[model samples]
Target chain A: MFKTVIRRAGKCAAVAAAGLMMMSAQAAEPIKIGSFLSVTGPASFLGDPELKTLEMYVEKINEEGGVLGRQLELIHYDDVGNASSARNFASRLIRSDQVDIIVGGSTTGATMAAVPLIEQAEVPFISLAGAVVITNPVKKWVFKTPQTDRMAAERILTDMKDRGITKFGLISGTGGFGSSGRTQTLEVAEAMGMEVVADVTYSGSDTDMTAQLTNIRNTSGVEAVLNFGFGQGPAIVTRNYAQLGMELPFYQSHGVASDSFLELAGSSAEGLRLPASPLLVPDSLPNDDPQKEVVQNYKAEYEARWDSKVSTFGAYAYDGLMLAVRAMEEAGSTDPEAVRNALENIQGYVGVTGVFNMSPEDHNGLDPDSFRILEVQNGEWKLID
Target chain B: MLAEFLQYLFTGITIGATYALIALGFTLIYNASHVINFAQGEFLMIGGMATVSLTAMGVPMILAVVLAVILAGILGVALQRFAIAPAKQADVVTLIIITIGASIFIRGIAQVVWGKEYHVMQNFSTDQPIEVFGAVLNSQSLWVLGIGAILVVGLVLFFTKTLIGKAILATSMNKEAARLVGIRTQMVLMLAFMVSALLGSVAGIVVAPITFTSYDIGIILGLKGFVAAAIGGLGSGVGAVVGGLSLGIVEAMAAGYISSDYKDAVAFSMILLVLFFMPRGLFGAKVVERV
Candidate 1:
């Protein structure tokens, strides 16, 4: 009876050892990607679309046989658009979850707050927000998909100049994104030999922009208006501009090219010039381009799923996830260092926005050349040559 | 130059009129409960959104506006009864924090319910521009300004001449004494909240056509309304109207002359400066407190 009991115990021990080995193999297996987004809050307009894009890319990659023969898993947390919340989530993603890579933050404030934590963890971090300062005080592991304020300002100024706008009225919000964009645009305007005739400012929440518009209208030699704000600022400006009967050419920051802008601005948004990626103007791009194909598919899928068209915020996040997948494949492993090296050395990778050529120095991977000038024609964005 | 300046003044005054309406709402609640209803802006949001949604659902414009106001008034009463009455005897700071929490919760629920989209009510008149002194203004602005004036005058008459209105005034003056005199002071407080919400919703409905409405519009609107109320004197109705209009004009003028981006900063700075000099507010009556 003792010998029989010992044999049964030996069998049980062998099975337990095999189970431990299988669990260990499964634990260190999948490529885990982390996302911190503002799925609720003022910036949810951007974050919700971004989260959708991330999910879409993950599904697409998994269907294409996964990255490096291992499935990619996304672990997400809602930052609620606050800097402190973003920092906490970033730490958890790095320390507790032990994600292989982190991708996509909603805003510059949140992204900037998480940057130091990410650098300490030595993990790759890609941002979808457009603040120029994020890349300027460059961290080694940080890469971004959205064009910086500098690139956007340069593009806007060049386009405005082409449209015979010399003297301009500038209006911006006092927030970080607004102030940064305003400064960059002013610098670009001066560089392009354009004069800033009037400069006006408003807080992020001001409903009436009439006083500012009136001042701009009164400014001597003001031939055009350049608005540097996002969210409701542009809507207020557009409405006031129409009310003031100002017929000067109006240019908005790239931030104004969303469905919410049209809804808020109404008919006042007609004929406004803004520089945006081809993602929003998919119908205008050539059929042969790889980006065109992907954008077409994405639009169809997104519209079918959400009953809405994709925005620029959505496109950036979509491209960000695709870029991460490519890097993972090239690195041939989920190792953070290997992925960082692969991403930094990325060359001629065609994306929904443009062909990206990432280098050691430039993390954005795209420039003003990636943007196309678009005008709101009949309440829809139409490409301008 | 004179015409342009007059145009700016008219524009400023019109916007000031809207702010005054919002301030009246704040004053009503503050006078009755001695608690600032931070969710007052949410009343405006609800008013605007309710009207827009109703109009979209084939309700007549007048009916939609009336429904929106009534709905906001109900919400106000519910909020007071549930959130405020429970913490009525709590410290002033605690009451303030509770109201703020309620505001955030309402804002969150608004996003979930309304889906983060901006909505606009149709203008009372056609959206065509009306020329006034070399400046073009929408016909809706005139309606907003007119409605604000009428509401202020109506409120003035109600508080002075009506029995219920005078009861409310008596309650605001001395809650315990009024209760001792057979007045239901709690009912007066509920009435004040309802009236305040009704006023805020009316303002929102009028302005929705001009500015459009969104889920997040409440926070800034609430802050500005509070500032307007503070600038005037928290308990004075006439002061709220005057203060709100003044704040609007000042913000407009600052945007016109200095920089538009700093207009909000200028408005807040003016309020801070006012509070620094006149702790009792611009028109607040001096009161003696006995311990």
Candidate 2:
């Protein structure tokens, strides 16, 4: 009689323990994050690395039991570097997926195209583009990780002023990125007391920029050539400059920060200078700098994982994702409004790019100091002292 | 200012040479088929892309150029036999759409073949620029000008001197009448596509040293060539030459003097002005409608 009673009690206890485990598993739902980028088109150079970086981090975070003890789920779409496609995907992410937060848009044009819809949806958006207009007026729900075009211009001008380059010739592209860069550069140039001797523009598709170069060469008192464009434009200008045998100091924007620029420009890229994130040359950074550790860690991990060099574009996405995660953790909720509040209050969070101090007034949270002026010496980037 | 003017003039002329060659190709194909082969630009792209790939594989430059031209010719013949001939029963608008579809299809194939990044070849001779009258011109530009001149002269002679050319011309004028006269209209049409493709590839090979080639390069070049052909008179070879060179010079002047931002607008605006005045184009034969 005693043995039968003990066996029945043991069976009841085991069944109750199994029932309690099932209930806990049902209560913990995964956190969903949505993203759209130029993953397979012309701008894939930017978006491909960014996507890889996000995947790498999400995997690592999940391996550590995720944030708030929930797994992270990523939903992404390839925008194909077109505005209409970006807008369509952005709408779908908001209406259909109903993700808690959104991140990405590799190019300036793609990012701007998705901004209006994202604003209406009231979801926290952290863009990976470099355009200043993304957060100039400050959307409550929007934040960007990359340094703005205005900030890049400011950095370039500061370096130029330090080098005593007073007269400048600006050759810009007719595309949206080039035009925006032109405006910001001109604004910064005027403020720095620099003289604009020649202003020329070229179509992005033009095979020959010699006509524009010739005009600039003939302009008097031009001490340096500042090219504000991307892709083959900068390379074409570099080739033409060398062909013309002009020895003027050459300055390019951060758009041509990748090693592909080096391969395209060949030997002509030797002396060109541009402002870029320290992630590009982590070894040259001082040991005491706060960003040095983060940049090194990211570069080592990414190159090991993908067998490819990390780009500032990828670093931007990394910073944005980490920032969003931190904000969510601090808010202790995945609610969009709560995340937005936490993000704006974020301060001195050291990311791979720099220390980010976000606020209601500033959505980007990065200043001109975040960029380091770098020069190409013997086909590799060297930190400019 | 004088040197700048010369510089712009030289650049314009060099760009105009490529445009002229493309316009000539447009003329030949349009004459034979009465269908605009929008895929003409893809022939140029294939030529450049093929040459680049072959040369990268250690093939001699001369052999690469010849092989690329032949390959382009074969693609042209295939395009006619497959894409165009099958759509013979379609209306004019449908034919145009078919050609557009063919162009896009060729571009897609090229993207898969060569990848999306732009590729460039070294100059045919030396990279040294020759100075003339305060203006500098690269040696490759000379090659472009030389070949462009030779092709123009060669085509004119072929059309006037060769019996085969006359049969092709006869077929173009009236396909039914030419068929009654024992001329094979289908053969003539195929020959037209082959010749046009050959010319486009030559232009591509010669100009690749100056302008880098990518899959998307075909779209703009095709539009420009079509515009040049329209301005030159749709069916006139000499008019294509004149129209292309003039368009180039005018565009360069506008970019140098007015504004580079409005350069494309200036070129297209000139075309609009000409079309507004001459409904049949400068060199096009006047056609009267019978109601």
Candidate 3:
């Protein structure tokens, strides 16, 4: 009987120890979040910064004891800036990785392609791309961190009106982004009582803009030139303006505000005005502004890590990840519906991009107020009022 | 209106000069090997990046340009030996696909090597705009046009007057016949690639300041250069220059007058029209094929 009792106690103690080990392992597992972006190809410039921003925020959150006492984990994949790859990445992240939430689509084409899959999976998605239709139809699972092209146009038109600019020359690329911006700008220009005197369109890769600029210059009563493009168009337009000796003020799309614009445009990009998010205005923003902190931190970390400058695309990704983390915490669960509701209810959350008050009706959560008109003066960007 | 038209013409000539340089490069290689090197643009990219990076590293401008050209020439030789020589007997379409594949592969490697940052080499001349005929033009544009003309004349004289150049011509005319006549055909092929790369780099170094270069710039420039070569009649050196200049002027006029949005469309359309009308190109001699 003594031997039997001793054997029974030993078996019980072993079982108890095994249970404790299993419990500890379970507790150590982190709450994983899925991320996808274009880390290569044409849009890599935008996606690389976004990836860096995501990494920085995830590190910060994890260092702060994570969200709701669970360590935050991010699983990132490079979509190579293609739509088909983005869709595959979305399905894999949702169905296989089973992440708590999915965030990021680097371009409008890629983001739009991934939406159906994200919706079907009933997962929350926040796109970093700036197409308005991504949110206009109001897909329940879709949200975006960047301001839409329409809002950018509204801001540009508002700035033009404030400056008493009436007659304009519009040059746009044949690509989707350019077309969308051109259409919106024209509509808003008409609404704002401005006349578009010349409408010139060019392909994305065309290096010479003198011919188009000449046509615009020939058009009667054109006071300003508004160029909508992503890559070489803005630089070409700026160069042509200088070449033609046109005295009209040149306005550029936000895409031209990257660090490479001045390098590509040489001296001609000086004094060029464009709409840009607050992320680029770190030196001008107030010290205590939340945006300033995020920008400063990102600049320091990114420069230290990659020896490169941060862009607006990076700012969006950083904000998206932070917002997602906050939502997860507020909901106190990893449930997709709860996180979505929390994101919709998010109020007074200041991000590197802008202040967010996301709601069911409005997914972008920011508008024209988020961007400031900036002028490139002596190879540096200066805020205009 | 005349001043504007003149200005467009001047701009067109400058760009045309650059295209001519690229076409000349294509012509040299195509004449020797009967193979189109699709990676010709990658050579331009490499040349631009090499100069920019070397200059940034504190090398003198002349030395940087020379080193860039030499390096690109070496790369051209390597590409031909490794990628092209193996498939010399392949069909025309197969050769074209191989060259294109080589182009993409080179571009991918360049991106990894240089990163995807736009790079610019400082202009050999001052960047101040010069007023010529009531229109402003960069001093670099004048340099590019002048250099392009000099290189074309130099190439023509070399091919016509030099013994080695004669041997190269002999090889290009008939590879089997040249070999039977004691000419080392393989060495001529390597020499062709080297000369082609040198021409491409020269163009790249001259135009880098005006256009700026990224890894992605190669594809468009290469395609346009190839188009210029085809339109000019592939094997004719003088024709390449004329063809490139005309194409550039036509494109500028089309963008200026008709529609900027369809400038590429106009260029490609002209190519199609030329191919349909003049199958042997503008200067190519018609050859009878025997089955």
- On TM-score, the candidate that comes out on top is 3
- In TM-score terms, candidate 1 sits at 0.92
How do the residues B112-178 of candidate 3 rate in per-residue lDDT, one tens digit apiece?
Answer: 8888877766678776678877766778889999999899889988899997798889998888999
How would you encode candidate 3's per-residue C-alpha lDDT over A4-32 as one tens digit per residue?
A: 89999999999999998898677758888
> Order of candidates by DockQ, top first?
1, 3, 2
Q: List the residue pairs that clash in candidate 2.
A: none
Write the residue-wise lDDT of candidate 1 on A1-385 in tens digits.
9998999999999999999999868753778999999987778888998998888778777787678777778999999999999999999999999998888789999999999999988999988889887887667999998888888889888887877878888888888778999899888878889888888787777777777787788878998898988877788889888877789999898887776788778888888888888877888986775678877877888778778777788888887888888898899887889999999999988877777899988888897978888899998889884
TM-scores of all candidate predictions against the true structure: 0.92, 0.93, 0.95
CAPRI-style quality class for the chain A–B interface of candidate 2: medium
Off by over 4 Å in 1: A1-28, A288-290, B87-96, B272-278, B289-291
Higher TM-score: candidate 2 or 3?
Answer: 3
lDDT of 3 at A322: 82
To one decimal, what is the Cα RMSD in angstroms of model 3 from the true structure?
2.6
Q: What are the per-candidate TM-scores when only chain A is compared? A: 0.91, 0.94, 0.93
DockQ in order? 0.65, 0.51, 0.65
Q: Can you give the lDDT of residue A241 in candidate 1?
A: 89
For model 1, which pairs clash?
A: A201-B260, A201-B261, A202-B260, A202-B261
Pairs of colliding residues, candidate 3:
none
lDDT of 2 by residue, A1-385 (tens): 8998898888888888788878767655788889998988889878989999999999999999898788888899999999889989999999999988998888888888988999999999999988889999998888999998888888988888898898989999988788899999999889888877899998988777778888889888999989999888888887777666678888899888877778677776878889888988899999889998899999999999999778888999899899999999999989988999999999999998888999999998998999999999998999995
How are the candidates ranked when ordered by TM-score, highest leading? Answer: 3, 2, 1
